[model samples]
Target: MTNKHSETSFFITAEEAADQLGVSRATLYAYVSRGLLRAHPTDSDSRRNCYARDDVVDLAGKRRRGRKPVDIAKSTLDWGMPVLESAITLIRDGQLYYRTNNAVALSERASLEDVACLLWDLPQADELEITPSVLPDGWHLLKAHYAKVPIIEALLPLFAIASEDGQTGIWQCDEARLASGAATLLGALFACITGCCPDRHPLHVQLATAWGQGPVGADLVRQALVLCADHELNASSFTARCVASTEASLRMAIIGGLAALSGGRHGGMTERIETAWQAIDPDNMTAHIRRQLAAGVEFPGFGHPLYPQGDARAKALLGSILPDFRFADEIVETMRALTGKAPSIDFALVAMRRYLGLPEGAAFCVFALGRSVGWIAHALEQRRQGQLIRPRAVYVGPDPGSSA
Candidate 1:
């Protein structure tokens, strides 16, 4: 997202520029046909237009005098196009891209109109309010829910007793504990499951005792737990702050956060991941790797940008509870052999889901549930802080002194 290389002047489209001017697309096209608008197209498609800052300002200045705009033949202008497209992008990289959410690279010009159409799409979030909370809040501090537990609470758990199972061993993904002991948050979660499961495997009973689950059910619960965990700074967070800033109820913020988590991205990744997993076959992992790579697709299970050494979360989950799952090893080894990388949380989660007999479509639910514990904790924290977060962006537009 760095724009250090971008010059002040750049390329933009008639459609995008038109929107900025509060003009209709048809009107902009008319201007383009006239000599008044300078259109820079990278290829045959005029939709791939780029505008020079100087040229746009110049045109804007010309329009200010109330002179009728002129039209020039499409053939009249022909100097540089790809160069123009390379400039004038909101989000710039080595080269300018349209920043469309479509799977295809925005490198090649996508439709300007379609890109603009998404302007209205908004995410929903849950609302939460807390009179006060002892935990930290927000997307960044999701893991803080566990690793950052209070000392008094930790001691209370050890001395406290549960109704049926004796102890509700709440394992934590604390970095220190992970390094010398259970190894990861994911591992900790799995151990908790095994600790709690009624039909825990003899070998896994120890793990269940530490974690806890049931053979007949808990898939939905687990998935909900993960999904509810953390959804990137979303609707709920927004609504919560909106309420808090106005000094509203804590309960409202929790509801806001809930609504946001249900949005297309957060609740949906599990489904997306499931679709990806189904498209890939763990049985023919080698073939699957080659096929996906040949097709120029990223293999589903490996490599996370955040975790360079492999996702510690994934490693902790796979390494601890399902320690003997060979498919996990196969995936890591084959991916390394094919692409020179390790597996990530998604991959590890998929493998876990696959082994647990959770349908591909349902894998994300597990993630959702895992995330919920953290989400509730964070919401509580945000409610506790009693501060509304509102980030601002730099205004890079026409100045009052400028002619246009």
Candidate 2:
């Protein structure tokens, strides 16, 4: 009998093999038959086979190298290539690093403020001078009138007002002044999200106090914030860089990032995951998952292309909370068993919100708050490069002079 293999084993199951190869099961089997991949029988089920992960990765790398330049360029937008360079964050070999520090390791002991300082290349959080900004005129009135609005939506106008009311000379500022502005803007963002004035306490503590959470909940919030601080030029971060390249104020760059992140496929994914979780029948999770799959419902937070093995941030956060949240653990196991995918950070954030009994949109709020740190980092980096982020189109449309 063959030995059973876990997810971390050198051998991966058939579904993972196919996914890594970007091929169908039949194609994967064909590869095995043609001796391009090696398959081993599983001990739990003799009929099922697993492929050697090294073989799949090697074949995938060769296939990638053989692709056309245009194909590679198109794939770049979908996790294909490194479009630009940054020293802020690196996702490699299934681990996430912020600069030279491991993000997961930092999350264990550092606060979001600490990660911000690290990503911003500052010596200490004190350099940020993270004092809350005075609210814009009519800010309270706007909040009271739009009290039922989603926090992300409500924040847009608030940021606009703040941007307009404050100094618009960020593009000409030195690093010290820029850092001060970033710190103030971050404090203001926290105030907007939590609907309370921030004091001298750390941002996570302020958030926890606003939400009525205790010390344990505050620590969880800290971990989530630190983990979500940056992810190497995600959509929102890219948007931020583009705006900053135009010499826009840091607040404006952050505004662009917020707009990008509000999309359902980006930071808004937390809400989708929350909704999906609500639809799931915890008692009959596997059956419900199968039914959802049969109906062509895409599970929102199960997979990430960057980490073909698993999202380490998700794993770290989930590892911390899953032992206490039995249903969440079941969902993670059932989803992996059914789809050969693992929970993403989105899933972990939603699970954390549920476990903490926070309000409905708390997950997204946490994401936006934490990710603002990254936006600031990218903005500062782009400003230093001092180049406009303009890309040429491939001109797929019909020629303008052609009458056809």
Candidate 3:
């Protein structure tokens, strides 16, 4: 064990800290800005800084852990056992929090625009007003390319155009520009999805009008949008962060999110559940489910690992509908009996879309739209961190000298 003198000698001067870490003064300052280091001001000269011994040792240990192959290569992409830190969102116990507010509770009062501004730390505005004049001119091409494709698929080309919109040199771009760009991208995508309404209303209003629903329908749209706005470090949000770590444009980063959301086990799970629900004969729900099970088919929307009791988003959304819709009530009852689990967000979205008379595949469209706000929020945050997210992999292929 070390003596008391050695224990008190742990704190070091700025030059000593720099030499010990083997990093330049500028890099050291950058670390401080990134919240990776803490510096204390000296009594005689405030300009001269002293770093805590434990903090420096922790940073050094993190650097070593990052370099070690076994630490990097332990795959936990499904539930992310490897904790990737972000200030964007947090899930505590069973509730989800976005920064300082409870997400499910926030959805009870806030609009999707309010949630977006809150997540981006913009000025407190009740709504995000995006003007139509900033709309990209490539809608003609987008219409041609995605004429026969699902609206979710069209997001790829739509974002590609938005990414090249006069925003140059990403590293120097400011927060206002990023936020405005996100608003425009969201507004334009909504226009494309809903068959191009000319009214420049708020996002929920535009969607409500496009689907020909009045106040009741608009309320559902708002609730779903708020609930789906963000989930902490989910697959798509992580993809957005990864792209932004490379200093990619916000649009490109959101496009990365869209690509990940299209995967079968992520957003595509909603599509599968929608298909299953459509096939159900509500009058004879039990017989229908039994037939499906006898045929070795498993229903997709009944359970979520994160919400064992039930998804709060699903409960809030489904609660609003089950009281009114007879068929939806039957579907829920049958699913619960078969699996002993409650419906998830995917199930709620599909049921809500059907209740509103939206066309098939509209559930995925809503999910993608609502989640785009989260993607942009994450991208902006990742940009501020200024760190590349390249996790290393352990090599297990043939040796360098071995022949194929």
* Number of the predicted model whose lDDT against the real structure is largest: 2
Q: Worst ten-residue run, lDDT, model 3?
A: 75-84
For residue 158, what is the lDDT in candidate 2?
66
Tens digits of per-residue lDDT, candidate 3, 284-357, equal 88998888888999777778766667788899998899989888888788778877889888889988998889
lDDT of each residue in 103-181, candidate 1, tens digit only: 1232023221122222211121121111111121231233334234422122112111111121112212232221112
**TM match of model 3 to true structure:** 0.77
What does the lDDT read for residue 157 in candidate 3?
Answer: 71
Cα miss at 74, model 2 (Å)? Answer: 1.7
- Candidate 3's displacement at residue 336, Å, is 1.7
**Over 4 Å off, model 1:** 1-267, 281-284, 320-324, 359-362, 396-404
Q: What ranking of all candidate models by TM-score puts the best one first? A: 2, 3, 1
TM-score of each: 0.39, 0.81, 0.77
For candidate 2, lDDT tens digit of each residue in 270-330?
8788788899886888899899998999678989877888999999999889999999999
What CA RMSD would candidate 3 show? 8.8
Sorted by lDDT (best first), the order is 2, 3, 1
Q: After superposition, how far is residue 123 of candidate 1 from its true place, in Å?
A: 33
User: What C-alpha lDDT do the candidate models reach, one value each?
Assistant: 0.39, 0.82, 0.75
